[model samples]
Target: MIDETAEQLRERVAVELERARARTALLTDAVDDDDLIRQHSPLMSPLVWDLAHVGNQEELWLVRDVGGRDPVRHDIDELYDAFKHVRADRPQLPLLGPAEARGYVATVRDKVLDLLGGVPFEGRRLTTDGFAFGMIVQHEQQHDETMLATHQLRVGPAALNAPPPPPAGARVAGEVLVPGGPFTMGTSTEAWALDNERPAHVVDVPAFFIDAACVTNREYARFIAEGGYSQPRWWSEDGWRHRMEADLTAPMHWQRDGDGWAYTRFGRTEPVNPDEPVVHVCCYEAQAYAAWAGKRLPTEAEWEKAARFDPATGRSRRYPWGDESPSAHRANLGQRHLAPAPAGAYPDGASPLGVHQLIGDVWEWTSSDFVGYPGFAAFPYREYSEVFFGPKYKVLRGGSFGTDAAACRGTFRNWDFPIRRQIFSGFRCARDAEPV
Candidate 1:
């Protein structure tokens, strides 16, 4: 993306926008209209709600905000306002039917494509490098990931499919050392980076050792076998309380199949592959597992250091592999696979210090809470990230198989409640290292 002129940015935005819409269509079109109308889970919006909501956002940002056009459907703006309705109550509203939602989104996208042809990219911060357009692309992609999770939560058979990722053929080490010192922690240069990841600043991190690959199902099973959940010592007071209240005995979708454990994904039930990075484990579960293994979850700074920092260059890169961008050979991203590849897959995606799969396969939970870096300033809108900066939400780094390359980067930060296990989440362990 080097020396990308406004023209190239516009093209990139268009391609990414189309890619996102394709994915959105794939997710929404896979299921029946009844499924789309029904809320798959209380924690997620009805599929039909998501279908139209993305259109409203596109119209709000691209058609209206950037194009100075009238609202496509000003009457329904409140209906699609995410803050206005909880996921559980979304289905109760007189929501757009599946066909109507599809039509609305398509209408908005057509208008957006027209605006993209001539939108100025130099006059304002939002249009600088087509930032607003990029933001909308990312928003839709993020919703695509959300809708994929909705599919996973649906009560029917698998509605989506993708080939499994590569096997963990390369024997990976247990952990890797991240040599630490003063290194830039955030990004001031990533054109599409969100407010929280902005105004890159120096962070003095100490040396630490992090899991070379994510904590796999095999590794996590050991924790479960060792009375990990029943034992309170390994869990924090809050974690133990929640574990008991939620009756969380294992990762979501996992159950005891005769002679071994089985996992269900997208309605397919199969024996859990021990080598795959464990998914659906919340922050508390990840933290407890780390404690059970005598390790700890990496801080956001440590995770980023292990991910983007290169000792030789003494600088940060856009991704683990490099500033170039994600590819199938580099990382498992863009929903190319339905689930995480076996641990140790994607050796090419490893960080310079030999930290593998740092960018994708699963969203690795960090020990850090969601907070803005120093000198952070909200641009375009404060609701994007400013409203969520608190100790309540834990930050997760890296992307998942469902995460699009256009939306995820080393500086891209994701956060959720610690007890929410419905998302595609996982973890890698880390610990302090003695000075060499």
Candidate 2:
């Protein structure tokens, strides 16, 4: 195992914290106060609320929890407490304006950085391994993603832009077979892994065939052309109800234009690219597409096994491409493209079994509910994961282009309601392997 020294770890933590702050700035700086305070959708907090909430969390964890300092702004704690206020109601609260929010986070960050320089690296799980620092960075980056979602939902002109992802290389047609076997499912030793992914365990999975790449716009278009939305047989009862109630004809921001499809992305309207992964799709949509294709969404176990299990080594890797960490060439991440790379774009990032784009491009919905593993225990707080353990939420594996590497891992778990389509989400299908 590679040993990271205290200084090395501290520098790494500092860099990640700064990167998170930079992303936050990039997302917020491009918008005006009106955009910041306005709630784009009932499901999301006002951008200003997220801005202040980021500071409040950093102050709570680093300034108060780790530093043992008095509260910086005790009066506003209730205002920014996420559990205390729902997204729709946040705009009604007296949130700090954009300038004030930026100043508040800056002050909080300065103190946190100071504390981090001297914090011991050997005591208390929260402080040890620089977990508190890492957690703060992850928290900020998550809010960055949420803010980006807000941007996507906003009605204004494009507020952000990046060069397009490199053109996809040769497409690997068809599915890869994951041999039947038990493989490590989660992580017991990933220092910064969240509570939900803790205490790695082995899971025995039957042989299955999973898509080599995420289902793309071209593939999904076939479902639409085949009257996927009109066919009740392809959708679950609840899923069909939600679809009918919403009257969704295509994925969010999509519309039939003449004989083709057009989509609004980051406030720009363009023809749908057939080769890119189909994103902004809800789990219900994924399920419907899978059903239409005579396949199924891979279960969480099957998805993880395909991404991490190595047949030759009989061990699991930290990432699909053997754990070396993500880069521009390996995966499309960190809002580098503001969109998914074309399907089959990152051959270098394929999993041991040659499953491509498993780490990035988009968050792939899985056919599993959000639940705790056996022997699970809530850490630091229960609200993080314990409270959400149930069938009410569906799981999404892998990370999206907006995801930070610090917060993403093979074991990282993301969950949401089955009907949520505003996130950057997509899916790849799977099926039982045929008997020899």
Candidate 3:
């Protein structure tokens, strides 16, 4: 970032900001006004709330903070204040309707782009290397993904469409060996990295074997076939209790289709694709499945090392493939596909240790709680990550198909309650290495 010239950074920031807005448009425009306003599920916000909130954030951060311009809509600040309101209760508030939300975001975007055309890229921490702009872009992309999940939950016809991901390329190795050693975790220098991913640190992990790609639907089906879910031995006390209470017999949106199973994706029901990585399984489910298969979920540090470490050079990469940016050919990101590409679809995207599909497809559950690393400090604000740091949330590494490249990186961190299943999540298994 420091090496890039002012013009280069501006162009990059503009492109990212535009990309995020374009996606927001696609997700919201596909649904009607009523659909946007309806609360599809208690767990997610109404589409209209998301639309206006995106604009509110842009106005608060860019239009006011970095640009030093007056508030664009100060009166509506509390209406969209996420901390003040909860997701289930947001619809009862007087949120901007569909058309009004669209207009507000458009107005904010126009001002932001105008400011970007001349805003200096140096001085303040927020402005340095255009980090604030990057933060806004990531925040918007994250919401866009949330909106995509809402579409999945909405009760209606298929409101969105996209060609399926590519088929599997070759017979990828089932698992790969990651030799035990200390490697760098998180980021210290990567531009646009969020507050929690800062102040890079080293973690010494024991040698372990991890799935080369994510655990595929075909692989997960085996666990189901063997009556994995019915057994309590594979499940922990909490997971067993939750399973009994929820009566969760299968992954969300899955149902018995005669002798096999079918899955509902964005309102379209079809036979589950055997070769694609299994999604919508909560951390508890993943943990149970791993136990049934005689394996365990990787630790957060192990997941990062497998995705970033290069044994030959003893240096971590910015992504699984290399330092290059993500693209259609490299990863299944940015809503380019409605579903995960078949396992082993992107051969070139494999990490140095031959781990495939680590970048995009599904967020892999890890066996670690969300907490700050040593020497951690809250920068700018504490709400973004600090508030959620505890044993309540488990870490999820990697990114999903709905995730945008701007919001994901090898060092990026995502955490959620272990019981959440509606989000597009999946897992891979790991096992201790043999005696040295």
Candidate 4:
């Protein structure tokens, strides 16, 4: 998936722009002037600033940084170059007002697109500037998600898509039984894997049972109703403390309204669509729920084993269904611009072991911390792994609904701060082998 073609890159950028445009529209309508002023503080930028920032970063990195284009505005280099300094220092800068800043952003995006249309994609030097374009696309993608998260935080639940009604059929909860065997656990050379996924090697794993599907809202609610939130015994020390400090009684978007639970999703508040996968939960929350269910989150290795067929082969696949790219019907991505699709919507996209939606819909939580593979090395973006290899972060596999399929692969690993739940994140569970 990493070795995406130029056309794929262009399409990805266009889709991201559409997502940004939609979220911007929502923020514009939802945010009052006071809210806008508050959103502009050092902690977080206003929605207007966020929109402009996405456009500016794309233009600065792709157009000016790579294409050698002139700046659309003289002060752009000084007023809004977020990459020029430490990220923490960004919010403290003197920023432009909403109207002019937004206009400049629109101009920059148009110019960048025009430049992209003219540039030769295949033979150019894949230099710092070239990498910058990829980074900017990913950066804007991240902001699109953040905009949704902040909007939910500020304005209650919203769906990234139309919430499909609850699952019509009976829920199937079981595990895919894996036989004991030797597996090539690490990444291989066939794909554009990060350095952390390199130095591929073989690993032998014992027989295990993994969940057939990601943990669902219905299942998690049973835990909650059974005093899962009140019981410290179900939580790890870190998880317990996290709950106490945050006073989190439910998932980030979850709230109670009478006997049933409701969650803020995709720009609207709706009932906890019981059949949908439980989403936007942080690592600790997912862990706690797994514990409550008398199970554990799958290790990154286990997750990869389930999602990937031949680890040693290093077969580059965009989705678990093979080298095929994403489609609306294959999974819950890019469909009418919403949050999550129903868990079972993508039977055709299932892994060989029948793991549904492994590559799209939501990022699945893994038990493994984000560390380098055996014999790790660094690449051009040196900070990609070294700075985040510490204990606090964890690996998340499978791309979310908002991610481009090209960026989602068997070996394509994504890491996140354990407690950061701003993205469209969710989890599945695994359990020890049952006694014969």
Question: Model 3: which residue pairs collide?
Answer: none
Could you give candidate 4's per-residue lDDT for residues 1-436 as a string of tens digits? 3666767766765665555555565555565555543453233455655666777776766767667988776565655554465434654566666666667767877777677655655555443223445555556656655565555556533323454532323344678876556666556553334567776777666667888778888888898889988999888898889888988887776889799999766557778777778888889888888888778998887787777664445442445677666666666653234566666766777777677778777899898888887788786456657778978889998877666543456777889888867667899988867667
Overlapping backbone residue pairs in candidate 3 total 0
Cα miss at 35, model 2 (Å)?
0.8
- Model 4 TM: 0.80
For 1-436, candidate 3 gives per-residue lDDT tens digits of: 3478889889889899999999999999998898989999999999999999989999999999988898878999999999999999999998888988888899998899889977877778888889899999999999999999999999979999999998888678578999999999988898789989987998998999999988888888999999988999999999999998999898899999999999989989999998899999999999999999899999999999999999999888899898888888889998999998888899989998899989888999999999998888887789999999999999998999999999999999999999999888999999999996
Please give each candidate's TM-score: 0.99, 0.99, 0.98, 0.80
lDDT of each: 0.91, 0.91, 0.92, 0.68
Model 1 segments more than 4 A misplaced = none
Model 3 lDDT-worst window of ten: 1-10
Error of 4 at 331 (Å): 1.2
